[model samples]
Target: MSKQPPLDKFERDVLDESVPIQQLLRLVIVLGGRAFSEPLRLWARNELQGYPGPGIPLPTYRMITAPLQMDSHSRFSQGRNETISALALPDVAHDLVSEQLPVTFSVGKLQNLISHQDPHTPLKLGLPGSAELARLMTSERSGQGVVVERIYWSVHASALHDILEQVRNRLLEFVAELRATMEPGESEPTVGQVHQAAQTINITVGDHSPVHVIAPHRHSATVSFPTRPHHRWWPRR
Candidate 1:
């Protein structure tokens, strides 16, 4: 039987970070760069530098990595590694911090929120940066800005639901690509090669940078991450 992957610290961080990203992607990261009002862009233009967080409305991100071989016998198997990431939309906070968004919370919150749902709700969402952030409760979005009411969200939780759906589809690409070929920083499993394989892998969400999104009227709390530190052995280069 194939050995099960271990639950590591990064696993928790990645899941945590993916939550807000899922939200930002759904709400702020819209269909196009032109989604933002031109006036807003102009206002924020000179003052608005490029960033990874929320600010611009719609943008794109990239996760770049050049995994070095881990096998002691592989060519580029020396102790060198590289990683790259890109962000879509951006925010002020993300601009100040660039790509350093929290990873542990985004993924965790997203998974918890998506797994369960009520059949009659408006996809309840807890407000960010408040006592609610602590509660982490699943509530519905009722009423509006000034008089918003918190209802339990369940049945109508289809909004953020698609992000994970996208994630799954994207994950298929990973599975598909790796299914037939040897992965970087990876060694082909061989009965006589070695009795042991790497026991630890590192996943840096967005690498040293965090993905951000931008909006005109509302401030966007954004998040984006890339699976990092995927380690294996290649050669002794």
Candidate 2:
């Protein structure tokens, strides 16, 4: 009988008795992708620092914090021929939210497992860039000072899911084709080669709670935050 692969640290941590999977699930957002860019490439390199064997590295864990900025613009018009000019506020408060605990996976092994199927097999995969946009508008005419407000919000949950799923499916298809084209006794392609060929990005938003704010208009405000976390993850060419 074939021996089962040993569980990695991440799997052990999740299955550990001390750390309840329920609470961890609440704190963690699981994201997987075959298309890897600088952010995930660097993460994989760092994670594989001491890993053994030729398989792809395990997932890496880190706490990422960054300043979020929001900007708004408003305009009012009476008719198609009329133009209205509104006051441009100099200083406006911006809402910022801090997210936590995002888990990322390389998923090369998973792709390899799926690639064992026939080359012509088809998988029902999601679209590439599914997204949702939300807008809200409020107006008060009877108030002493008229207040007209509009809010625009967007989220990429569907898009992220689509990219991840499609990337996996594509990887499977590529691997199947490669296997089919090889000689009868030729060696198969490595997981790293398959991963290197297919690169993608997948993100999961965990918590959207407002953490802190940096007001450039106010000198007293504390504006201490690291430069974008993804910048540090650029892969060394």
- On lDDT, the leading prediction is 2
Give per-residue CA lDDT, model 2, range 8-32, as digits (tens): 2333444454543323222112111
Clashes of 2: 4
Question: Which sections of candidate 2 miss by over 4 Å?
Answer: 2-152, 190-237
Worst 10 residues of 2 by lDDT: 127-136
Q: Write the per-residue lDDT of candidate 1 for residues 102-176, one digit (tens) a residue.
A: 221233344565667563533432212323311221122112112112211122334445434444343233223
lDDT of each: 0.27, 0.27
Whole-model alpha-carbon lDDT for candidate 1: 0.27
Clashing pairs in 2: 35-199, 35-200, 36-199, 36-200
TM-score of each: 0.26, 0.24
Total backbone collisions for each predicted model? 60, 4
- The all-Cα superposition gives candidate 1 an RMSD in Å to the true structure of 25.8
